[model samples]
Target: MAEAQEDEKVGGFLGWIERTGNKLPDPVVIFFYLALVLIAISVVCALAGLTALHPTQVNADGNPLVVMSQSLLSGENIAKFWVEMTKTFSHFHPLGYVLVVMLGAGVAERSGLFGAAMRAALGNAPKVILTPMVALIAMIANHAADAAYVVMIPLAGIMFHAAGRHPIAGIAAAFAGVSGGFSANILPGQLDVLLFGITEIAVEGSQLDPSWTMNVAGNWWFIFVLTFIYLPVIWYVTDKIIEPRLAKTPFSNTASADESVQDPSAKLSSNEKKGLNRAGLALLLVVGVWLVMTFGPGTPLIDEPACPAAVEAEGQCAAVQRLAPFFKSLVGGFMVLFLGAGWAYGSAVGTVKNHRDLVSMMAEGMRDMGYYLVLAFAAAHFVALFNWSNLGLIFAIHGAAGIEASGLPLPIAMGLIVLLSATLNLFVGSASAKWALLAPVLVPMLMLLGVSPEGATAIYRVGDGATNIITPLMVYFPLVLVFARRWSKDFGLGSLTAMMIPYSVWMLVTGLLLVVLWVFLGLDLGPAAPIAYSLPGN
Candidate 1:
C-alpha cells in the first residue's frame, strides 16, 4: 500500500514522460524522419547563405576556409546520395564493430558459458554483501552486452529469494547496476569500440584534428572509477531504501515451474564445472595469443614508423601512438576471446561438436541482429545526410563561438552536456544511435572549446546511463518489468519506476559531480586521452 502511494506521487511526472516517449516514433523511424528534416533544413540554410569558418582548414591563400551549407535537394547531392547509399550503410563505423562482437557473444551466451559464469559469481555470495556483489557482477556482465539482461537479472532474483530476502530487491539491485551504471564497466568492451568508432567519424568529418583517432579505452579510467562509485550507491539504495519499502509487500512466486529461471544457489553439475574450468583456460590462451602478437619478436601490433616527429624529438614515441595498432586490434581480440572461450565451454558441455556448430552459432547471432541492421541503415543515412548538409558543423561552430563569447566555464559547459544527454535518453534508448546523432555536433562543439573528443564522449556517457532506469523508453525496461512481475504479480510500470527513481537520482547527481571534478582536475580520461585538447597549429 505504501509502495502504491509512493508510485502515484512519482508517477505524475514520469507517467507523462512514459506516454510522450511511447508516442515518439521508433528510433529507426526517428532517424529516417530526422534525415528528412535535415534535408529541408539544409535547403533553407543553403539558400540563406549559411556558413562557418573552418577551424582547422585554410584556403590556398592561407585564410580560414569558409564551409558553406550544401543543399541536399540540389542535383549533385541527390545523385551522390543515391549513388552512395549502399556504401554509406555498409561502411557505417559501428556496424561491423557490433556485429563482429555479437557473433562471438552469441556463441558464449548460447553455449551457456556467460550464464554459468554469472551464476557462479553470485551463487555463493554471503547475504551480508550480496547486494554489492550483485551490483559488481552486474556491471562487469556488461561485457556480454544485452545478453546480460536475460541471464543476470532473473538469476539475481532467485539468489535473493534463496537467501531469504525480497526477490524484488535483488532484481532492483541488478537492474540498477546493469542499466543505470551502463557506462561504468571496469574494462573496455564492445561499447567502447562502438562509441569511439563513432567519435572517430565525428572528428574526421569536422576536420578539427586530423591526427585524432579512436581509442577503444578512451574512457577507461573514468569508467573504472565510476564502477566503484556506483557499487555503493546500488548497495545502499537496495538494502536501506528499496528493500524496506517492499518489506510490507507480500511476496509470491507467480512464475510457473517450467520457467527457465534457475535456483543459482543449487550446486553446479559435474559437466558444468568442467565446462567452466575449460572456458577459463580457453580465455587465458586467447589472451596469451594477443600478448604474443603484441610483445614478441616483431612487435606486430606496434606501429613504430607512425610515431610523430614531435614525440620523436622528445626521444620516444608517445604511448598512445606506439600502441595504436594494439588498441585497434582489441576489436578482433574480443571477438576471438568470446569465440574461443565459448567454443571450449560448449565442447566440454556438448553444446558444440565441430566447425559446423560454430558456423551455425555465428549465423544465429546475425539473424538476431536483423533489427539492428535495419536501424543502422536508417541511422547511417541520417548521419550521412547531416554531414553533407553542413549544418552539423555550422551549428557546432556558431554554438562554440557563442559559448566562447559568453565565457562559460568549461566545467559548467560539460555539466550542461550531461544534462542534455540525460534528457535525450528519455526519448531515444539506443545508445549507439543517440551517440551517432549527438556526436557530430557535440564532439566538434566541445573540441572548439578546447575539450578533447574523449572528454565529450565521457560526459555524454554519464548522462546517457543515469536516466536509463527511470525511462520506460529504454529497450530493456519492459523486459525487466517482466522479470519483476515473476515475483510481484501486481507490480506496475509506476511501481518499478518509482522504486528505481532513487537509484537514478543519486546516480545522476554523483555522475555529474564526478564529470565536473574530472574537468576541474584536468585528469586523463584514459591512456593518452586528456580532458583538454588544443587545436593543431595553435
Candidate 2:
C-alpha cells in the first residue's frame, strides 16, 4: 500500500508540472514579457536613482565611479533602441553562428548522410552493447544538428525492435542522450559556439582582462567526461528501469507490413554505403586542408601580429593574439566541412544532383531555422536593452558579493548555480535563450568566485539539459510522445513524463556531482580553459 501510494504521489506531482508547463507561453513570448518587465524595472530603478560603481571604469580618466543606470524609457536611450533594432537582431551572436553552422549541416542532413550513418551505427552493433552505442552516437549527433532528433529517435525504436527488445525503450534512451545529455559531446559543436558566443558578450565590460578569449572549445574536456558518464546513465535507465516497466505492458503492433512505419527491419541500400565511404573521405580531406592551413607555411590560421618588429623589441605585442584567426575560422571552417562532406555524400547518392540542388539544401537549412530567428529577434533586443541599462552587471556585482559573504565553498557555489539553472529550465525550454539571459549575470557573478566563464556555462548546460527529457515545454517533447505512441497507444503525457523523471533526476544529480568533483579536482575543461579564474589584480 505504501509503495502504491508513493507511486500515486509521484504521478500527481508530475501531472501538475506538465499542466503548469503547458499553460506557459512559448519561450519567445516569455522573453517578450520579460523584456517589458525589464523595461519597467529599468524605469523604476532609474527614477529611484539606483546605480552601481562600474568595476572596470575605476581607472578611466579618473572619471566618476558610479555608472548611472539608464532607463529604457529615457529619450536618448529610446532613440538608440529604435535605431539599433535591426543591428541588434543581425548582431545577435548565436543567430549568425547557428545559421552558418546549420548551412553546412543542412546539406549533410538533407543529403541522407546522417541517416545512413545512423543505420550503419546500429545495423551491426551487438545487442549487448546496443544501448551504449545508441547513447554515444546520440552525443556525437550533436554535430549533425537537427538530424539527431529526426534521424536518431525513430531509428532507435526501429533498431531496438529488430533486436527483439521493446522499441519504446530505445526511444527513451535515445531521447535521453540527445536532449538530456546535450552537452556531453566529445568535441565542440554548434551548441558550444552558441553558448560561448553569449559568454563573450556577457563578459564585455565585466572581465578585468580585456584580452581574454572565450574559446568555443572551452568545455571540450569536461563534456568528454560527461559523455562517458551519461552513457551508463542512459544504459542503466533504459534497461533496468524503463524496459522492466515496459515488459509488464508489452508494445502492440497493430499495423500490417504495408502500414509499417518506414520498415525498421529494412537493410540499407547499396548507394548509401558508397555515399558513406565518400562522406568519410570528404571529412578527412577537409581536416587535412585545415591542418595544412593551421600548421603548414607560416601557420596561416595563427594570425601572427603584424607588429613583429614591436614584439621583437618589447617581447610581446599587447593587442595581437594568435588565437583570433583560429577562433574566427571555426564558423567558416565548419561551414565548408559540412558543405563538402554533405555534398559529396548527396552527389554519390543523387539526393543532390547539381550545385543548385546543394544550394537548395542549404536554403532549406535556413528555412528550418525560422523559429530560432523569431526568438533571436526578441532575445537580441532584450540582451541589448539589458546591456544599455547596465542592470546585469550591477546584479552580478551584488550577487557575487552576497554569494561570497554567504561563505559557500567554490564547489557548493557552483552546485547552487546548477540548481538555479535547472529550476529555470522548467520554465524556459530554449537552451540558447536561457543562456543568453542568464549568462550576462551568471557568468560574471561566478567569475568573481574564481570560476571561469567556461566553467559557469558548463554548469548551466548540466541543469538545462538534464530536465529536457521530462519537460512538456521542450519543443521535442510532443514529438517524442508521438514516437512513443507508435508502440503503445496507452502512453500519455503523464506516462511519458513519469518515465523520464528518473532519468532527469539522475542526470541532474550525477551531472552536478561530477561538476562538483571536477571543480574540486581543478581539472582543465578544455584547451587553455581552467576550472578557476582570477581577475586582473586578484
Candidate 3:
C-alpha cells in the first residue's frame, strides 16, 4: 500500500500537474508511465525471444502482441508495432466507434436529457422500490453501453436528493448495480457481443469449426437469472448497509440549475407540442419498422444472409439473426434516433432555428471527447506494447497452470480468478484493455481445464467489474474525490479512500460469492453461452 502511494507520488513534475486539476489524473503523465513501462517490457521480451509466446497456442487472428513482437525487436520491424497502435485511433465504426457514441451521449448528457429522464423516472417510483428499481435500471442500461456511467452517476444523486435519501448512497447504490452486477443483466449488452466475437475468434484459432455462431444471446440465460439475484442483494446492501454507513456524510452540493425540479413531460405550447408529437411519431414509426423487419422471415435486417443456415432457411421459421454486426450497430444508433426526435421537437418548439443547430449539437457533443481521444491514443500504444512483451500471456499461462494443478472445481477456480482481477483493479482501471490482455491466456487455458470460453469470459467479466468503484487507480476515482471535496472541504486522497473502502470490501466479497453460485448452478451466463464445459476444444 505504501509502495502504491509512493508510486502515485513519484516524479516531482506529476505533483505539479495534479495541482492543476484535483479531479482528473494528469493523462500526459499517466501515458508517460504507460509508454515507458510497456516499451521497456517490449525491449526485454524481444531480447529474450519471449515476444513470440502467446497463451492460446492457436494462431491466426493472433494475439495483440503478434505484430508488435515481430516489429519491435529489430529496427526493421518497427512498422508492425506502429500499425497496430495507429488502428486504435482510426477506430472504423463511422465517426470513430468510441467518439461517435460519446458524441450522441454527450448531447443527451449536456442537454440534460439523460439527467432529467433519470430523475423523472426514478423520482416517480415509490420510495420503497427505489433501491431495487435503481438496481434493475442499472442492469438494463448495460444494453445502452456505458451510458449509465455518463448518465446514471449524477442522476442517482439527483433522484436520491429529490426522494429525500442520502445522495452519496444513491450514487454508491447505482454504481454498485451498474458495475457490481456487470456480468448479470436481463438484456444482451455490448459486452455480450464483444466477448462473443472474441471467443469466436479464439475458437477459430483451433480450426474445429471456424464459422460457429456465438450470438449476443449466448450469455442471455445466465445474465437474466443473475439480474433477479442481484436486485435484492443490491437493494439490501444499499438500503440496509451502504446507506446507513453514509447517513452522517453530507451530500455533495453540485446540483445544477438545469437539474432543478421541472416536469420534462410538461404540457407544451402549440408549436413545441407539435414538434414533440412529430418526434414521438417518428420514433414510433422507426420502432414499428424495426419490429416488422425483426419479426419477418427473409427480411434483410433480420438475418445474416451470408451464413449458410440464414440463407438456406431464408423466409423459413428459424431464420432470425439478431446478433449480426449490422443489427448490433444499432447500439449507437440510439443517438441518431434521439437526434431526429430531439430535432423534430426543437423545430416545432422553436428550440432549434435550423439544421445548423442540429449539426452544432452533435459537434459540441463530440468536442468533449478530445481529452479522451488523446488518452486513448497513448493507451492504445501502451496496450499494443504490453501485448508485444508477452508478459501478460506468461502470467496468464502460469496462473492457469497453477489453477489446473490444484484440481479445483470450476466454481472455485473462477472464484479465485475473480479475486485476482479485483486485486489487480487496485492498480489497473481499463476493463477492455485488461481483459484483452487477460483473455488470450485465460480463455484458452480455461478451455483446456474444462471451462468453456463463454464461461471464462463470464468469469473475467465478474472479476474485472467487482472492484471498479473502490479502486483509486480508476480514472473516475479522483472525480469522486472532487465530489467529496464539495461536501467535506478537507477531503483528500486518503479521505475518499477511507469513505469507499468499506463499500468496496463488502462488494468484493458479495459479488465474487455470486459468481461462485452461478457456476455451481450451471446457469447460462448469457445467450448461447453456458456456464461450464461440455467438451475440450480438441
Best by lDDT: 1
lDDT score, candidate 3, position 422: 74
Error of 2 at 419 (Å): 1.3
Candidate that would win on TM-score:
1
RMSD of each: 2.6, 3.8, 7.1
Give lDDT tens digits, candidate 2, residues 387-505.
88888877887888898888878898888888988888877888898998898889888887788888888999988889988777788888888787778766777777878988898
Which sequence of candidate numbers ranks them by lDDT, best first? Answer: 1, 2, 3
Judging by TM-score, tell me the better candidate of 1 and 3: 1
For each candidate, give its TM-score against the true structure.
Answer: 0.96, 0.93, 0.70
Worst 10 residues of 3 by lDDT: 63-72
TM-score between candidate 1 and the true structure: 0.96
Worst 10-residue lDDT window, candidate 1: 3-12
lDDT of 1 by residue, 224-326 (tens): 9999999999999999999999998777865524267876887888888899999999999998998998998888998877776777888655567788888
